[model samples]
Target: MKKLLKYSAFGLGGLVGLMLIVVAIVAATFNPNDYKQQIIDLVQAKKSRTLKLDGDIKLAFWPKIGANLGKVSLSEHKGSAEFAAVDSVKVSLALLPLLKKELIVDTVYVDGVRANIVKYKDGTTNFDDLLSKDEEESQTIKFDIDGVNVTNSAANYSDEGTGAKYSISKLNLKSGHVALAEPIDLETDFTVTANQPAVAANAKLKGNFLVDPATKHFVAKGLDASIKGDLLGGKDVDITASGDIDAKPDTKEFLINSLKLAATGQFSGAKLTIDLSAPELKALKDEVTSKEAKVSLVQEKGSDTFKANLVLADIKGSPKALQSSGITGDISGVQGKRTISGKFSSPFIGNLENLIFDLPKLAGNLDIKDPALPNGGVKGNFNLTLHADAKQELVDSKFDLKVDSTQLNGDVAVASFTKPNIKFNLNADTLDLNKLLGTSSAANPAEKTAANQKPADLSALKNLLLDGKIKIGNLIYQKYRLSGLNVGIKADGTKLALTGLNVKLDDSQIKGNLAISQFAKPLYTFDIDIDRLDVDRYVTANTGATPAATKTSDKPLDLSALKALNADGSLRIGSLKYGKTKASNIRIDLKADGQKLSLNPLAAKVDDSQINASIGISRFSDPIYSFNVNIDKLDADKYITKSDPNSKSPAAKSTGDTPIDLSALKKLNASGEAKIGWLKLANVKTENVSIGLKAADGIATVSPFSANLYQGNMS
Candidate 1:
């Protein structure tokens, strides 16, 4: 037994020695060029067209023992061309013996590789038609890579049909050890591509990967990168970046850690770099939408947390994802509301710092710090802030839009702005008067000579005038669209109180109040009084009323040619002027329910020959007027023969054949009432010196309404 055991041991030793020599020869006799054929044969075995290998290789104990490579890249595409590049890669134990309708690769190590796969414009790829039946049939690959690294590798993918494109750049996955029993378990880099406009970036990742062998699930940590870019056409921007992310596929979610960015460059032209960890991009977006998002320094332990400013809203990017949007604005002492989502964004401005939110369709509240939205060619709503001087004077201003497309309620259309807290409310169910005002402008007379009678852009009218507190300007009404209507606005002292001011777009003028607030007591109202106002120039724009071969007047005043279709005819109340007396608080009221009007009593100044009418015809918008008072007892001789017959009557009065000396009334003493109708001035007499009278357009008429005997001959 001893002898037999000894012989067995010697024989075993001889066999082992022979095996060792063979392995030694195989391990040391490998030719570098032979690797090409070896890889080709292996790839061919799997029916693959292109086989690329790189990185150092190691073999131990000869061909029968084991062979290993540092790192290698394995890629596949379907086309005539091919693409290849490599970094550290390794593989051991070819496992040729394990081939039987299967390929079981053993011992692999890969690190730091860069590769690019491109789909050219001609509907072809870097590797087209490069797959064989066996490779095509292989449903999965198993990898046990100890170390792998990829950096700054980029690839482009384009569609053959629509010419759409996708790309990845600056991709890097380093210092990671992973195993992929299935394809999806493969750990890779995140990057940004030019083709994906909506997706600005996805970059930064590296570390260990424990992927589910069959389920293709993966978990990642310490993945981070920088992001930067503009979103809207120079109106919106996202430029600063840094963050870290961790992804766990089995849990179907990701987490964001240590993410931060700053605002520099044109927000429209912004750039960003980041070091953060997030499970998925969705989680990062949600973080941005938070009312108060916090981000820490990626590399520092004592970094300040930054909070986002100017919270707009964090609704989904699409319209259907949100039901409504709103905003807020405040200045000196005024405030108002409007629907931002349903109307236009041009009328107002909004303000936000470090963020340019140009919302063409964005809806919200709007309030420019400027007392009023600065007037100009600026389009749409934006962020704006305005400043006022110590003396309550307008100073610097920023015109940012706060709201977009805001719908309005029916009763209120627009508000006119002249001073802070002094916005005039205008109402027009069928037509907005302010909108029309905004659309009308008057060209300079030098630009509108006989050679250039055409109207210039009428919309700039408001821009042509001083914008501030009222300064007693002329209020002319002309060619009113409304029919048979009269309106007036009056003010007393520094206070303005509108009365009987109205507008009926298709017909006549309406009546309203013109009370303005006082400076010392902003809460208190004031009313103003106007002596005379031109009725024609206040209504129509871009128009004129020139006479055609004028004719002299022959008949007495008739006074009855005005009617209101939509608005009631009422005079804006003002003080009544008569002989030796002036009545204050004179106002005309037109009742809507009954459409009736009441005129303020009058104050008259009477004379013997002719009665001087102290009334003003402030009714009607056309070139017509009516303001004639009657004289009960007047001497016709004295009435017709005065130096100046109340010189205020050329266009407003109609004097009959028994011309009265209205010019003398300024020096005479008399008394009587001035009859006033809808738009008519009538009957004036002082003493009985009968002298019938008339005025332009018959706005003034006197019945036997004349002066007593005085003129040489009676009519």
Candidate 2:
């Protein structure tokens, strides 16, 4: 028609130029290392398994597309599978028209892939049963992405029920896939290494994965994580956190739905938020170590409630009982969800060897609830009032707690508990007894130089702080001491009760009542009552004595009591006016057992002697006697042969009785028995010339023995 349209366009341009030279001679023999062994035999024939390649399997792509096996081996049944680094894999064929699949994966660049995921301890797995079954269904595929890199991956974990094994080494990850032909999108980066060190350094974690191909259900966003280390012993921590997670699509057992958490960020940022619908898990994160929980925690075993607003910054892989320890803020009431509240705002700095004690920089608001965990949980309760300051190791106390509660039942050890706990009201107030005797100054400074030096080597025995204040009533820390100590002083073993047990070196005050019923057969009881509140600076710092006057015993003395409450000795308070001696109106009703003291008939008008006594103080020469005295009246020859003389009685030993000096009878034993009644009779006292002598310091005058003298035996 126009020469047949120019020979039909030159015979179709010579048949399209001979079909582009026969496709450039089949793309020039198409040999790019034979298409990289046809992509390693098409990924070993769709993973029929077996694939090993170390370099040389490359196809720089441009016509050869992509292929770089580099270092590879994919067996997977549980072991023998190493990609060790692929970094380049871009196979191609499907360019998407409508939906076609010639097995195309336009991109796959893996880097340093060293994956070792095991599951033994009996769970058995080396990837057991390696991926199978995929009857072809690429609802449209033609990927396009180039990103994959992982390094130093190590993950080891075992769990033969409870033997538990752990390991997770340096891992750095990066994954990618999203050239979106649809249905395959991924991007990940994970780096976590603990115990294997590096600990992510002050750490910052990120996690967010979404999957909902209709309902595979997995929508995690802003995932959070936190960690710090060494807190209990104190020092160095910068913790942080962030959160949001989900898992619950019908349960394969990954039930943790939507949560929110937060934490500051100046080194380690921190935050924690938990959701409930929980049925179980929390022994820190129950994978189960078994103390036999969940019956509600074992049927209301008690204690667990806590309110928090924490500030944990220096946190890192803890669990050596919380390495060094940590506790910061928010507590109004807490009983059992376990809240030991510390880092020390006031547990009286509870000497854990007192490094510096911290943790209670609290912001109040706490609650505890325990007693509901025999199986279903919620049986933990505890309430605590907060206010703590005082540290030299710790003192300056104030604790007020009410308890129809007690539950730290991860089964005990917080100082030991066997259950059966109750304290309707517990109150520990202002106790700075020199930091419980550790030489307080808030201790610290190495416990103030080890409470003032002295520890080159001493095994065991470290707790010692005889401070004060303890007004308990039921008393039962091993038995006894209920009614005896009036209500305090449990003694060296501790129950303590002091109105003012001062000790600033001198100004001491102590009213007595000390008891111990059992500390391995211990029964030291006392009803001691002393005055002169500061008795000559406590007898010049205990027994250097030397005070007969200075109006010093520091006043407060006014003795007039005699009621041993009944163990014998019913009534005998006839003037015990001490200091300047005044045994005066002495009346006695005694019943002493063992060394014997039977003053069943004792009446006295001392010094002027209208005394009637009967005392027997045997042995040691025998004459500390105050046994018979019916002194109806006595001058005792000017009171024992002119008063004053060692009362000279050592002469008679022709087996007749009279030869004292047991240090003159252990220095006249005194109201504490050794001798003393009948107004002292040593030189002579039968009533003045009628004789009356009180041996040198003990006084004893009995000449011709006063006619009123009754029944006696002295020594």
TM per model? 0.34, 0.24
Compute the lDDT for candidate 1. 0.37
Tens digits of lDDT, candidate 2, 1-715: 9999999999999998897687667556666555556666776676555566656654433333445555655665423455223333434433333245333454444444454555666777555555456768746544444544554445554445545444444555544454433222233334343332223333344565566554565645555555444332222333444344454444322324333332222222222222222222222221311111111101111243333333322222211112223333333334434333322121212212122233332223223233332222222233333221222222222233322232211111011122212112232222222211222123334444312111122111122123333332222221112211222222233322233322222221224444333333222334433322322322323344443222333222221111111123334333444333344555555553223336656775655646666564422222233444455554444433232344444232133354433333224422222222333345443222233334434443344333333453332
Tens-digit lDDT string for candidate 1 (119-183): 66676765565534464565554444444445555666666555567766666554434444322
- Evaluate candidate 2 by giving its C-alpha RMSD to the native, one decimal: 24.6
Among all windows of 10 consecutive residues in model 2, the one with the lowest summed lDDT is: 290-299
* lDDT of every model, 2 decimals: 0.37, 0.37
For model 1, the superposed segments whose C-alpha errors exceed 4 Å read: 1-16, 30-82, 85-128, 135-143, 151-154, 165-173, 180-220, 228-369, 373-715
> What TM-score would candidate 2 get against the native?
0.24
